[model samples]
Target: MSKTWFITGASKGFGREWAEAALERGDNVAGTARNLDDVQELVDSHPDTFLPLQLDVTDRSADIDAVRKAHEKFGVLDVVVNNAGFGHFGMVEELTEDEVRAQLETNFFGALWVTQAALPIMREQGSGHIIQVSSIGGISAFPTVGAYHASKWALEGLSQSLSQEVAGFGIHVTLIEPGGYSTDWSGPSAKRSDEIDAYSAVREEAAKRPSANDPGKPEATRSAILKVVDAENPPLRIFFGKAPLGIAERDYESRLQTWREWQPVSEEAHGS
Candidate 1:
């Protein structure tokens, strides 16, 4: 059966690819970008299948309207992919209060608003998928990506709690933790800290490394993600790409090792 996908940030990257894949599979897509004109070609080619909407995921009214329009067009929404977000690369202390808040506003709260808008419709239907395109940073931390990590980590926590809340209604939540895919996420949108003396030394070194926009083996990662997203019963958390899997594995292992190494001390401190 072909599912209906209402995806945010479909102008580029994973969201655009996913929308294309969905349409290729005979699914209907209501794709949104900050300016839907950017997706004019997609919409024009698939007039019936692709519905492009001008949307800012951060805008509450726009979210509501998008959901309404999607439901009106398809009658039911099978999936809502919250893929609209950017990255902020800087040490925690280096980021200004507004920058940190902006990170959360777009990556975390933007997703929340979209999901909140879609939940009622899905609940009424009694089935739907809510896929959040988080990042490996969600599960693990890195040197200059602390604010980015915080945003994703917030999504992970929100999704975990939301999964529990909506499980009874047959609504599913999937968090896609992708590491390095050749997306513009790492372009100028990827924030960098100013020359704050506290982080300049480390920032300067990290700045030389490639970002998500850098050339990479993205096809394999895209293929893996398509398989997961199109699967009948996809996993709650997906770690896509080689870098993501490696980071996830190392993070899990490090956590386990820490727990084991501190078991006795923790037990004594907690009296457990």
Candidate 2:
């Protein structure tokens, strides 16, 4: 059966690729971007199946309207991809309150709002899938991109809780933790804060992680998301790419070690 998809950030990167993939497979897609022109070709080619929506997801009301329109057009949305977010690059001190708020507004709260907007439709329909595009930064943090890390980390937590909350409604939530994709996410989509000289040495090293130019083709992620939505029982979280496992392993192991080391002190507070 052909499913309908509502994807944010559909102008480029995984969002665009996913939209293209879905349409090629004879599915319908309503792709949202800041400018509809970016996705005009798809809309032009698949006039009946592709919907190009000009949207800024940071606005909760706009998100609500877009979701409502998509549901009205498609009748029922089988998948909702919250992929409208950009990378915020900077150390914790380098980022201002406003900058952090902006980053959260788009990356964290935007997804939350979209989820809120879609839940009613999904709940009413009795089945749906919500794909949250998180990053390896969500699971592990780096020096230069603290703001980005914080945003993704919050998203991860939010989606986890959402998954539990919506399970009774047959609504599935999947957190996609993709590593270094050659997507425009780090290029035209990324925002940078003013550099602080104190963090320059580590900042230079952190810059080597990944970006739109280095992440490489995102075909695998596009494929994975499709499989997730189509599955009868999708996993709560799916981490993409090879690097994620290594980073996750190290981070978890280090955390475990610290927990074990502090167990005695931690238990002392219990007053047993």
Q: Which lDDT values do the candidates have, in the order given? A: 0.84, 0.89
TM-scores for every candidate against the unseen true structure: 0.92, 0.96
**lDDT (Cα, 0-100) at 65 in candidate 2:** 95
Model 2's alpha-carbon lDDT is 0.89
Per-residue lDDT for 1-272 in model 2, tens only?
99999999998888998999999999999999999889999988899999888899999999999999998898998899999999888888888999999999999998999989999999998999999999888989888788889899999998999999999999999998888877767678788899889988897787666443345458866677778889999988888886777889999999999999999999998897
Q: Cα lDDT for residue 271, model 1? A: 72
TM-score of 1: 0.92
Q: Sum up the clashes in candidate 2.
A: 3
Candidate 2 residue-wise lDDT at 6: 95
lDDT of 1 by residue, 1-272 (tens): 88899999888888888888788878899999987778998988899999988998888888999989999999999899999999887777778998898888899998999999999999999999999988878888778888888889999999999999999998988999887766667786577666478667887777665443444454454466567767777789987765677667878999999999999998899873
For each of the candidates, the C-alpha root-mean-square deviation to the true structure, in angstroms, is: 2.2, 1.6
Candidate 2 off by > 4 Å: 210-216
| Model 2 TM-score relative to the real fold | 0.96
